[model samples]
Target: MFRILFFLIIVVSAVEIALFVWLGNVFNVWFVLFGIILTGLLGALLAKQQGLGTMNRARLELSRGRAPAEKILDGLAILIGSVLLFTPGFVTDTIGFLLLIPQTRKPVKLYIKKVLLEKIRNGSIKVFRHY
Candidate 1:
């Protein structure tokens, strides 16, 4: 997993740099910089709003004595979206925005949940308790 993640990071960084250079040449360095900043700011705000909404739903569920499992998944997606949005890359920001949007977030959350459950069943993931 670490190796896969490291490879992904390297690939993403290279792609981001390539995009930056291409855009800078087509427009201007300042324009590219502005785009990066704008995306980060807007993405952060969207993620935050979605996250708060998810949290509220979770609280409402709890008040009704129900488990907020789906809301928790939404929160996880929002958290990941927030991180990706702040990562400074067009691809990441686009993906981050998708995750932040409830319409798109459901698929992403389902994928994550599926993977996690598979890992748990296969013993690739484990839970530990502290005393």
Candidate 2:
């Protein structure tokens, strides 16, 4: 896992640098820089707004005496999306925005739930009760 993560980091960095250089040459350095900054700022703002909504839903679920399982998963996705948006890369920013969109998140959330359920069924996920 560590090896794969490290490799991915290296690849992402290389791709980002290559893209920066290409964009810089095509549209000037300042334009490229401004675009990167604008995307990051926009994505951050969107993530923040969505995060607040997700929290409210979670709180409402808890108030209704039910576990906010879906909200928790949404929160996790939002967190990851926020982090991706914060990262200085076009690919990450695109993925981050997708996760930030409620409409797009529905399918992703369903996939996450399905995978988690499968893990539980296979005994790959361990659950512990704390008293």
Candidate 3:
């Protein structure tokens, strides 16, 4: 796992740099810089909006004495998306947008839930209930 993570970090960094250079050559340095900044600002605004909505939903669920599992997953996706958008790279930004959009985020959240459930069943993750 560590090796895979290290390799991915290196590869992603290289790809980001290559893309930056290519975009700079095709357009201009300032244009590329401006795009990065614009995306970051837009992503931040979107994340804030979605995060607050998710929090409200979670609160509503809690008030009704129901678990806000779905809302929690939505919040997680939004948080990750926001972080990716903050990162300076087109690939990350694309992924970030996917995670931010509710339509796209549903599939991602489902996949996350599936993986967590599998892990718990396989003993890789443990869940304890207070009650």
Candidate 4:
């Protein structure tokens, strides 16, 4: 995981530098800067909206004496999406938007659950959290 993250960082930096140079050549540097700012603002607003909706759903489920596990997953997806959207890139934004949408998030959540269960069943997901 660490190695993958390190590689991703290097790749992302290279891509960002290339994008900056390309955009600088094709359009005003100031416009690219504004675009980055705009995307950040949009991402923040979307995150806030999604977070509140997830919280509300969770609260409603709790009030009905039901487990709100799915709501928690949605909240987590929103957080990840927010982080991705805040990243300056078309690739990140595309991925972030997918995670933010309910239809897309559902499959992603299910996939995550399946992977976690598999790890647990294989005894690879050891309990590390302290109570």
Candidate 5:
């Protein structure tokens, strides 16, 4: 798994470098800079909106005496979106947007839950505190 992950990282880096070169030649450095800035602004706006919505939903769930599972999922999505948004690339931006959008988060949340459950079942998941 580590080997596969390393290889994927290398491949993604190479692809991003190639894209950067291509875009720089086709358009300009300023265009790339503008794109990065635009994505950053858009991501910030979306994060704020999603965060408030999640908080509201969590409050409502608590009022109804239900667990805030949806809020947890929303929080995870927000974190992933933020990380992706910070990464430089249109691909990451697209992924970030998908994670930020509530409609797109359901399937991703389900997939993450399935993976986590499998890890727990296989005893690959562990808990540790550094405090």
Candidate 6:
């Protein structure tokens, strides 16, 4: 797992660097810098909006004596998306936006839910109910 993570880090860094250089060459350094800043700002704003909404839903679920499983996943996605958006790279920004948008996030959320369920079924993750 560590090896895979290291490899992915190296690959993603190379890709981001190459993209930065290519975009800078095509549209000047300032334009590329401006675009990065703009995206970061926009991403922060969108993440805040989505995060609050998810929090509200979670609160509602808890108030109704229900587990906010889906809302928790949404929060996780938003947190990851926000972090990615804050990272200075177009690739991460694109992925961040995908996770932030509800429509685009649905598939990813479903996949996560499937994985969690599988883990639970296999005893990789144990759930203990207190009540």
Whose lDDT is greatest here?
Answer: 6
Model 2 residue pairs with clashes: none
Stretches of candidate 2 exceeding 4 Å from the true structure: 128-131
Summing lDDT over every window of 10 consecutive residues in candidate 3, give the lowest-scoring window.
8-17
lDDT of 2 by residue, 64-123 (tens): 999999899889889988999899888888888888888888899999999998998999
- Order the candidate numbers by TM-score, best to worst: 6, 3, 2, 1, 4, 5
User: Whose TM-score is higher: candidate 5's or candidate 6's?
Assistant: 6
Tens-place lDDT digits, model 3, residues 21-40: 99999999998999899999
Model 1: lDDT to the true structure = 0.92
Against the correct fold, how does model 2 do in TM-score? 0.92
What CA RMSD would you report for each candidate?
2.7, 1.7, 1.0, 3.0, 4.1, 0.9
**What are the Cα lDDT values of the candidates?**
0.92, 0.90, 0.95, 0.87, 0.87, 0.96
Tens digit of per-residue lDDT, candidate 4, span 1-131: 99999999899878877887788789988878887788788878888888898999999999999989889889889999999999887667777888888888899999989998899989999857766
User: Can you tell me which runs of candidate 5 are displaced by over 4 Å?
Assistant: 1-9, 120-131
lDDT-sorted candidate list, best first: 6, 3, 1, 2, 5, 4
Worst 10-residue stretch by lDDT in candidate 1? 43-52
TM-score per candidate, in order?
Answer: 0.89, 0.92, 0.95, 0.84, 0.80, 0.96
For 44-79, candidate 6 gives per-residue lDDT tens digits of 999999999999999999999998999999999999
Q: Write the per-residue lDDT of candidate 5 for residues 54-101, one digit (tens) a residue.
A: 989999999999989869888988988988888888777888999999
Which scores greater on lDDT, model 3 or model 4? Answer: 3
